[model samples]
Target: MATFPQVDFLKEAGLKADRILVPSDADFVARQASYWSCGARSLRPACIVQPRSAREVAAAVRALVSARVPFAVRSGGHTAWASANTIGADGVTIDLGYMDWVRLPSDEEGTGKTVNLGPGNQWGRVYSELALHGLTVAGGREGNVGVAGLILGGGMAFFTGRYGLACDNIVEYEVVLADGRIVSARKDGDHANLFRALKGGSGNFGIVTNFRMRTLPLPPVWAGMTIHPKEAIPDAIRALKDFTDDMWSDPDFKDIVVIGALIQIAGVEQAPAYKKWLEMPTITTTCKMTTIPQLTMDYSQAKDYHNTWFTATFKNDVRIVAKAAELHDQLVKTLKAFIPDGDFVTQCLFQPFPRLFGQHSAAAGGNMLNIERQSHDGLLWLAVAQVRTPEQERFAYTLVQDWVHAVRQFAAIIGGNLEWTYLNYADRSQDPLTNYGLENILFMKDVAAKYDPEQVFQTLCSGGFKVSNVKLPN
Candidate 1:
């Protein structure tokens, strides 16, 4: 017998039966299975609430908070972390995937500089819709990443070189407060503190329903992947060294080398910056002039894997990159010994993170990433291992942990370590909030208390990087 009171309370709170799903419901099973991570899919939420509008989300929040039920807010449910979006049978999941709408501003809405996005939207659909008007926003680089998670984590976008992070470009957030009050948090508004806190502070303040984001003109881009052979690693590394900024390099763990790219040089088919990489040999090259939406579709991944990911930041030194690759080899060896075949993919990606990005953020209402503190260019390094089965997931977790530790130690030895740990790629075990610095931490805490007096989001709303978990003064 399902004894979870959340279902009844949700119904009593005016949410339609169709909007709520229990373990007994077939749609509930399908909804749970829809999460990108098999680990998340395995969990059993007592009921999953599919809120189609802000008012519906508010009602759910009110019911769940009043009843003292632990709940989680899920947007797109793309993360591989088990508890990130899904909860145990004791809780409910506020799956916002149905609220996936995008709209350009009418004359009555604010300046045409911004567009409204639903929290449930995935970047690919968002990009495709926006591209219809020859426009886009500084959103997620990967198409499948949820708009909410990416923006809340201080998103790294395709146009980060010219603009800043996805968070930096947010003009306003229509957030449902802990007390079920719907409010708009914007730079020019009365709730300005909450506005900044929600940027990089993550899903601790409120459940955002609509994201009003600054839009940019999307032009044709010269982009795509270029796969390198195993023997060309040294040469590829050289080319990367010479390049100012390129697509994130994802060399496969199998050691059959690959350098997949989705880089864009706006308004031109070819840029001199990529000359070094273009000169190198490769197995496959998809580099061509294409739209951002088309390029993003090419980068979407299959959701059938048990995944473990960890990240760290370091100086943009070739030694650190080389050391990371060496340690990745060790990790791959250990993982193969444990799993011994089947489907497994590992990546050691180093994305370009320049310090000036912070300046760009500051110019546009600012974000909490705090990477601007670094006066030089850096690399946001991500180590990912996706495999089959829970057993493989556990083993891969340990292996990836060791690899990240080894890489950090090597960075320390070479004095190549940096402070910022981007929340988007961060593992659940990591504390990316503290990396935002003391000022930002204090600012977020104050905002959390002011907006959520009872600390509903901090205490009851489970999942995501919580501001309550930090040791800083509240």
Candidate 2:
């Protein structure tokens, strides 16, 4: 028999959110689509409640507590891997999608520059709104990824070199605690530990209803890929080394060079053959760029939507690239053994870490992110393999993992450590914080314990990153 408590107490608590989805409810099929976390394979919750306001959220939490029922909070349903969304056929879920209300806070600076967004507002919406101000925030690139997941997990953006992770730029968060109390936490305020844990530690603490982030100055960036034939693989690999080395040595040049690769159908049929796109000859060379809009001119032409991507970090040493390429060649050959038709899609992505990127300016006394917050330089490499359908998801994940592991092993051979995993783009099997080292890990766990002494966050919510819950080294 199920031991979980009943959620009927919600009615008396004055919490209204459409209707409570109980286990016997016929809408479970529709409700299940939102479980996109990495561990969604085994998620079966007892009930789901969609609250529209922060007050209702508090009321609902209080009701669940009164009934002694465990529940998970969800924003965009992007954190699919966590068991937090799943109620084990007897737990409850507090879905925040209904709370997607973005408005300019009264306390915002008079410039109308700073915007406070609801946790449900996706990055695309935020970008659209901020672009009107000739401004943008350093946010996730994907159009549909949620604001809550990214900010809570220390989101990495395309312009991180100029600003910092999404978490670093956050100004405030309106959170609902375990006891159903609503509180506003800032860089310097009461429950400062909660503010720090909210950044990068995932939703292991509480449910954040609204997030306040600093905006950035919008600029036309040089972006786009210059595709070359497979024969140019050797030069292309070497160019990866030279380009990263140059950026590291001359950090100011971070604007001039940002290189990444893609592998998929390449023809006018694949994407609209604009004159700029049509101009590239089928040859070997580096593609230089000057604007993002100009570069993504044919984004609608891309084939794969669920493009499999894995990232591995290499040391500041230039020799690591050459070593990585050698391993990359071996992995390519191994994968080729599976598909000899030469129709497979696989490529490496690399970015330079300039000196300016290391200016550790996180909220004071808040989330401690980045393993070596000082002068650590390396190429944040991504292995983007092709994906065409749901069936191919497993294959794509395996190939990406294999490539990252091989590259990390190669880095070890060249005297480099595989530290720092990007939260937004990393695989479920990857441990993002492990790269932060033991001292930082211990610090994060201590912070989590301080804010959530009852262990409500660590034991109840099983989604997102949990520093206190991570498996310790033997």
Candidate 3:
């Protein structure tokens, strides 16, 4: 219903009329309606701009700034937050779906047979394309996740123990800054500081157009899922803790254990211990050696419901896991009693964050996550609430917040509390950037100020976590 003043400016700046879609266009309506989360789908941007190249993105950015209109950039549109990658009424949205391109570079010496990825490409497509070459990159564990948003938010992968977080594996980034400058940022290049900040910095500095990441051999991996009844939760918690404790000795093992209404352990391994562990007293699914693309695709089915996520981190203590599992049961009971007919489901996942993950990041030019500073092995906990309607979504949000608070309090009581929060799994209310500690927060602020002096990203591009709110230490 609102007017978009920037439409004329964008057209005059060399953006073709066919590239811009207004509300009347069926394509624009379809794109706005199809989001991974219901909250993002409810927003209505004035117009959508589909830029096919970085130059077009630069022109759009310049036009939007000159017109002084609010805008948001969307890659895969997977973020759960309401307005994260989508814009509200009276704003313009720069959708990068048309820019989805994946290729291998000709100069493989300096870049080391790396894969060039567009921000618009999903992890599923990237893996499928690279799998043809017998190669893979450390990326999102879920195939449907977008390349740009996940990398910007510090991506976690099944190969994190072996290769590190997805952002750490990136060798170069082609970014379009707030002032319309296109630049390549690398570790040893002129924008080295910007390069480090972009790792786990959450789109605060610039809009990343392309990512060149180091590829690893795509050998067959032993991967599968193991499901257990509700009564087996305590055993699952104990096993997870034991696995985290032993990961220091054997970094080849990677698994994600969910302890909630039902217990499931999905993992990939190369050691014999994995097979022995699979033989434990529980119902196990088919475990076989498979390719990375197949393994990721197995878990890529999109949930047809409203989803919300909140996260926490704690030391790898069996007590913490047990207590969280107990709390999860109570939370589910309360939700069922309040919203009896609502199709609300809760998922609590515990992922291992061994010291090896940090070591890998350190080896590959340090990132803003600063996971290396953690002295002990830990677990990153993600609590997701899925509902069928708006009313259920409201209740789910409150219940998830209470659940996170109770877990943090219990951890503090046991002296096992941790300060870090994984950015990719964080909710809107949680400040994952500030949780990176005072030093990293200050460094991010400096990078944001240096590259974007006018704070265009902090102010105009008002999606995701912003560095402007990070406070320095006294």
Candidate 4:
């Protein structure tokens, strides 16, 4: 197979030898193995380029464009889907793990309202650093989630109810465009169009190096994972529904493990807002007074396993929730039969996607999600399956596909169906960009065309859902 000969273009760009890697290098194996999913870890790229800063990223982009080589950009390598953050030997992978830096507002031009984050910084490190300064940003609830992909794909944060999503909180982005120019995109900046598109636009426009995000004063949270037995699922669903309704309601919905309820009210052992879930019979409770960084670390999942995820949106309805529970039970039974041995874990989560959060996004300069257009308070369902073998992975894929279809079909029957999916939790088989609504899609496409006239990201840098309704090249 063609290998290093094709990677000479990056070397010809005058990149330091240490920044480029071939299969022969020991570091290449380590980098490949570092991905969160075994499927992504197994894809062997022709070469991997590690750029330290926006300028270095710009140089790599220009070289790839000049050579007309297919490429992919990765920050945290957290996406579990194959080729989402990787490429095969036919392409090169731009590994951005080296660009992880957090510049506090004081460290920047004294914009205390915002903090600058390098795309490579994981939420764990970002929160840890920001916590030291008594500040934080609306970011991924999982510590291991990368800084770039989450915001670019429309992140839902612990503070989403109060501050909106991570994308909504982004004040500016320092991006490396297709032409190799490193430009800053802000709501009122010259690249304002690009700025709005970058909010939930995924990787369609350019490689983002730095995310200047609005910061908030750090607050200790009353949050943690509360694991419940299958019997208590009804209580859990009722709690979720009530939580989404923002009012106290009768508890009656029951089936999988329920694991979250974080409130910003500090110094309180239990916020009344979370009394229902807290009252449920639990196997365990990590719920307590804690800071953002600690909460994220506590909730982060184990990586390096073969993982699959699927998601859908629906208005909060007890019947729909019950339908999902039934489907999940069947999926689990199928998985149990499929995997009699080795590591096998699965989760079906339903988080609140309140319309207020969408309205907040619109108020915060708007985003590609257009969630503000939502007419009802909703729940975003995420189905995650992790297996030990490729065969199990395939089986799990088909099983979840059926599960999603059944749930959507059932929701449609009950008038609870919604045409949206959370991009970050989506598997490759799902098309989240199209679900973002046609208006948002068209806006993102126009911005991509304006900022990247060559369509390099569309045609070469392959990964994630494309805003133009076209699938990413394998």
User: What lDDT score belongs to each candidate, Candidate 1 first?
Assistant: 0.81, 0.61, 0.82, 0.82
Give candidate 3 misplaced runs (Cα > 4 Å): 1-3, 109-112, 259-271, 275-277
Models, CA RMSD each = 3.5, 6.3, 2.7, 3.6
Residues 21-91 of candidate 3 have per-residue lDDT tens digits of: 98888999888877778878878888899999999999999989888889998988888778899888778
Model 3 residue 358 CA deviation in Å: 1.0
Model 4, position 435: C-alpha lDDT score: 72
Give lDDT: candidate 1, residue 93.
95
Candidate 2 per-residue lDDT, tens place, 1-474, comes to 333344557777875535566655667556665444333524667767778878888888778766667777766665424453455666777777767765656776556556678887666667767766666676665555678888877776655554566787787889987777898988789867677767777776678888887766666543344565555554555555555455433322222111233211111122221222223344433344333322323221233234565777767555666655566677677656665664456656566554345463442333555533635556677676553344454665676687678768867876785467866556666777676566667767786676667777767665555676566688
Local lDDT at 360 for model 2? 37
In terms of lDDT, model 2 sits at 0.61
lDDT of 1 by residue, 1-474 (tens): 756688899999999989998888889888878788888888788899999999999999999999999998899788879888778878999999999999877853644578999999999999999888778888886688899988998887777766777888888899999889999988889888888888888898899999999888777677777887767776766665545233333211001112646365374554556666677776888878777787677777777899888999887778888888888888888887887764699988776666667777887777777877777667778899999899889989988998999989989998888977888788999999988888888888888888898998877888788877889745
lDDT of 4 at 16: 86
| TM-scores of the models, in the order given | 0.94, 0.77, 0.94, 0.94
Worst 10 residues of 2 by lDDT: 262-271
